[model samples]
Target: MGADLYRDGVARLEAGDGREATRLLEAALREAPGDVKVMHALSRALDAAGERERSVQLLELVHAKAPSEPEPACELAMALLERTEDTRAAEVLAPVLAAQPDHPGANLCMAMALAKTDPERAKAHLKPASRSADADQRAQAAALERVLSGQSPG
Candidate 1:
């Protein structure tokens, strides 16, 4: 039952129906409070619903509960970046980078965080990000690579 709710919540989130997604995910969380995936989904739904602070808070909870889990760390960094808290985003990615230097999401988020202040380092990070399965990440990595190479982003 909880898994069904989680799946429906994710589908609703992907469809951009964040309110319904949030409702479904909250129900899923009630059924399995320790489920990190449900928490992550709820956090994403909150973010999509414009509850940025709430989203960050939930991600933080997941991070605190599972410090060794990379998904929560990556999601938290992405949420921070979305809030324009680049420094905080970078800080959040630090441990993830230390634990998994080649973590694609961490590298991608770090690349965006450092792009303005450290183009060379950002380019290096983008190497892994460009290879990510997420098309948006790939596009951003490719565009940043072009920018760092002194060519117009194509």
Candidate 2:
């Protein structure tokens, strides 16, 4: 039952129905407490639903449960960055960055966290993301580069 709910919730989330996804994911979590995959999916649904604080909490839980993995840390850092908590985001990312310096998502997020306070540092972080084969990541990196370079991105 929990797995079914989780699958449907993920489908909804991928289809851009975050509110429905959240409801189903919450039910999944209740049926399978402490399930990291469900928790991560719920965090993503919550984030899409604009429940950033809840997303952060769930991401934190997942990260705590699996510190060796970088996904939760990256998600948590991005969530913190969305909340304008750059320092906290940086703190969350520090270890991940140290362990996987070239991880594209981590680099992109670190760039975002440092963009305002240290444009040069952000530029360094953005380099790898810009070179990534993922078009979205490259676009984001390019946009950030424009912003840092005092030019408008369009």
Candidate 3:
């Protein structure tokens, strides 16, 4: 039951129906309380629904519960970066970056967090991210690199 709801909720979220996704994911969470995966999905749904604060809160909870997990840490760090909490985001991402220096997502988040204050470090991280298998990650790294080099991303 919980797994079904979780899949359905994620499907709805992917379908661009954040409100419905949130509803379904909320029910899924209730059915499987303390499930970090459900919590992560709900966080994404909440963010998609424009409930940014709630989404960050949920991400924080997920990070706390799964501190050593790269996914949750990266998600929470990205959320913090969106809020301009660069230092905190870097702190959150430190362990993951340490464990997997070439992790595309972690490097991207770290690059974003350090871009303003430390362009050199940001560029260093971007080097690995630019070679990511994920096109979007590579694009973002390229864009950030352009910005750092004083060229417009366009």
Output the number of the lDDT-best candidate. Answer: 3
State the C-alpha lDDT per candidate: 0.87, 0.90, 0.92
Which pairs of residues collide in candidate 3? Answer: none
Q: Clashes in each model (backbone N, CA, C under 3 Å)?
A: 0, 0, 0
For model 2, the run of ten residues with the poorest summed lDDT = 63-72
In terms of lDDT, model 3 sits at 0.92
Candidate 2 lDDT by residue in tens digits, 1-154:
9999999999999999999999999999999999999999999999899998888888999988875457888888887877899988887888888888898888898899999898999999999888888899999999999999999987
Cα deviation of 48, candidate 2, in Å: 3.2
Best by TM-score: 3
Rank by lDDT, highest first.
Answer: 3, 2, 1
For model 2 the local lDDT of residue 49 reads 97
Runs of candidate 2 exceeding 4 Å displacement = 152-154
**Regarding lDDT, does 1 or 2 come out ahead?**
2
- Collision count of model 1: 0
94 in model 1: Cα distance from truth in Å?
Answer: 2.2
Residue pairs of candidate 2 with colliding backbone atoms? none
